[model samples]
Target: MATEPSPQRAYRAACPNCGAAVEFRSAASALAVCSYCRSTLLREGEALRRIGQSAELFEDHSPLQLGASGRWQGAAFTLVGRLQLRYAGGSWNEWHALFDTADATGAALRSGWLSEDNGGYVFSFEAPPPEALPPPEALRVGAAQVLGRETWSVASVTTAKLGAAEGELPFVPVLERAYVVAELRNAQDEVASIDYGPASEGRPPRWYVGRGLQLAALGLGGLREDSTRELKGRSVECPSCGAALAVQLATTQSIACHQCHAVVDVSKGVGADLQHYAQDTPGAEGRGGGEPLLPLGRSGALALGAGGTRSWQVVGYVERCTLPEPGDDEQSFWREYLLYNQKAGFAFLVDAEDGWSWVRPLTGAPQLGGSTARWQGDSYRELYRYTGQITYVLGEFYWRLERGQRTVNTDYQGPGGKRLNREQTGEGGDAEVTWSAGAALDADVLLKAFKLDAGQHAALQRDVKPLSSRGIGGLAGLFLFLLFVVIVFSLVRCGRDDCAELRSLYGEASNEYQQCARNTGGARGYGGSYGGFSTGGGGHK
Candidate 1:
């Protein structure tokens, strides 16, 4: 069986600033940061440093194991695996789970248990945008740079994770807990990462592991750390400030100095595709130092439909979305696609730059004036509610991210003869109604429809129960068949008439006579023969 990360060794580190005793977090890595001065201190690589006063401790209040249950938005949710990542002074952890929503008011959803961690948690979908997050603050800033473009009134979201760590970003613990110390390394194979938790002896950090990749750790009272493949090798060292920095391989084009925060355009600085460093250094540090390097790669995650239309959906860059509409001008900026599922009777419009656009009309209740509605907590009549039938299998959702733009053209039509179609040509945020469209509403209002109160979500699932067809008719038919079978068997007995009187004559031996009838064909008289319908016994006649 695969086990978690291995145990980590504790060490004391000098406060690079105050010279007061400090410590290392994990057993690996060369440098250690001073708790008092926060100065970046390097070790002689691959050697143990010193120790200091130990850190604090924290208690885990949750007993939730994998697959635990919880209640949210009036629905029950199943616990998925958790994501835990450690970086900087603290770490972040996130739980990936799924909830089954039966109705809009969220009353039909199940309530699963929840594990709350002060260490850190993902922002609730309902929480207001934070101060530093970029796209969410587009309202205040006239125009912002995102996905390689700048736009006014663009829709954007600040993601807390990058690369593989995107799934779970760990946050620092509010209360103290036991943590591990580790030695970090740079791309050029230098000993860089350092950790300090419980076991500090008042000195500097020294220890090295892994030529490439970053680290993943489980923090308890004691230290535990290990190497990981999640991190890309590209690391940064500031020439001006000498501060070490980690380069996020996913979206970073330039290296930002950790101390000075100077943005370094690596392409201009280095004339090569990747950078290199020496493997040897002094003072127990693994690799001494070398020129910083960064990779010129383009890799980004997919965001499904955030907005759409009657016959289609609008998706693409955050900047292309005009917050509320996709004006005809910005339509070309985002890549588009159309998707259809005949079994579920649904369609999707995917915009590469924005997100996904989904639609499913309800044929069950045919009425006058077919209109699009959204799914909200109280009613399915809201704007997020699509007029349609749906079956979400194995937690798969109606919305998903796609690679490029494609459209589905079908004979199925919507209100006023609108055919099933996906088009990229539309006006800002929501399309302007000038060409026979309508006003685009706010995303928050639509998102609110998804928010479920704990109890309401569970209630909606209870009302609908599964049923089998044919009802009592199936039972009655079975009983009558059995009765008919018994009558036919009795008529085929030995004596055609007055069989009961014959039974009285047989007295206590009647059962024996019946057995004889079954065993030896009963002389073809009072009882029937054993062989059925073959002999000319009265039973057969």
Candidate 2:
């Protein structure tokens, strides 16, 4: 078995290929990449052996680096190594962080992987082997499976190749070799992953469980200062229209041109692999219908958490339509604007006919019970369910999106004008669920935040009023006021003597003619006799 090594003092070895001095910080590390020649070297007692060459690390917008120190959960750790992995869509960094804790034997030190995923970071530690492991073929994305005591839903299953490595690592990693990885999330937003080794290696897959964390929570220092500036200022001309387009982030895969409205694929870098839809002509499919409510490159401050706010820029915009069932002719649609920030990842500003909601993706799946779903201790009632199809897209996105892409959406209503949305793509076990929670915002507030003119877009002029407590209170007050007016009118009419006399006379008329004669006789020219009427009160013939 591979075991940890005891702490060694002042360990240094000279590279055999380039004769460059290589330093080892952890005694357990068996391999190190040469800083000067980029050669992979293995340590054998007192000598260093050259194994292979390391690939060059790509320039990313990440602010983390080796030698940076930070604290996590009251424990301090230092970033000592990194493994850059590339996938079909993009690449990510798995930073090897060495903790202050020691192993069981106290001979070797412990380490973990801090992976950068989708503009967020996840810290994971190796967990104990499960009782029984499932084969790769048996696992599917979005399927609920039991691991240990927690029921987890698979979020993604992807294959990644080792692009590059630096500093030290606990195990030897093959360069350019592809491996399988499965990521799962539970109801509490906690994340777990399984890293399956290359099939040829015959090594058992490893499991890890951890939580998602923000960059600010790490309290890291000595990060690369120019990372943000480089990413923000990066620009390239569109291959289709030749218009200069600015790339939003280093990880952006697709960017749509503002002039020609063509979706450009930037996975191979800017101005490469551009594609456009056949129906991308002017005024087709509501493409050129109206201006966007929130224009691209506009920024606004949003309150994300307690005592903290983040400024996010509107990077991408997409309009999607929800068609009624197969035979129905009615169609409904909404618009979604993608918001991005370096530290906050991505958020969405959703505009529908009902109202506007600021949405952010949830880290975990909410627990569903019958017609209700619970998230963060709050229950949401089912609002509506429908299918959404992509109509148009503009600006940059982290994922590859195309027109006519469809998704099944379920919306739920929560307390305080909040909304919970569940969107699923694909079917059966291969489906993917994306959950988002949002609160309704006024149209004026949204426009003011983005500094947009209300009259520019007709959509912005129409505000969808939500059912709020204050509005309900106003309705209740109006109902009570009308009731009070009816009661006052009845009392005033009763106080008048004329109304009493009329009511008495009407009561008597309701009886037979005898009662009428008794009540109104002698008052008029008629006498009290019912058969014949006397001319006067006496016998005045």
Residues 75-153, model 2: lDDT tens digits: 7777878888876656778898877667566766677888885566778888875646677667776567887777777
What are the candidates' C-alpha RMSDs? Answer: 32.3, 24.0
In candidate 2 the C-alpha lDDT for residue 258 amounts to 76
Tally clashes: model 1. Answer: 124
lDDT of 1 at 109: 25
How many angstroms is residue 406 displaced in model 2 relative to the true structure, after the best TM-score fit?
2.9
Candidate 2, TM-score vs. the true structure? 0.78
TM-scores of all predicted structures: 0.17, 0.78
Candidate lDDT scores, in order, read 0.25, 0.66
Error of 1 at 480 (Å): 64
Lowest summed-lDDT stretch of 10 residues in model 1? 532-541
Task: Tell me, by TM-score, which candidate is best.
Answer: 2
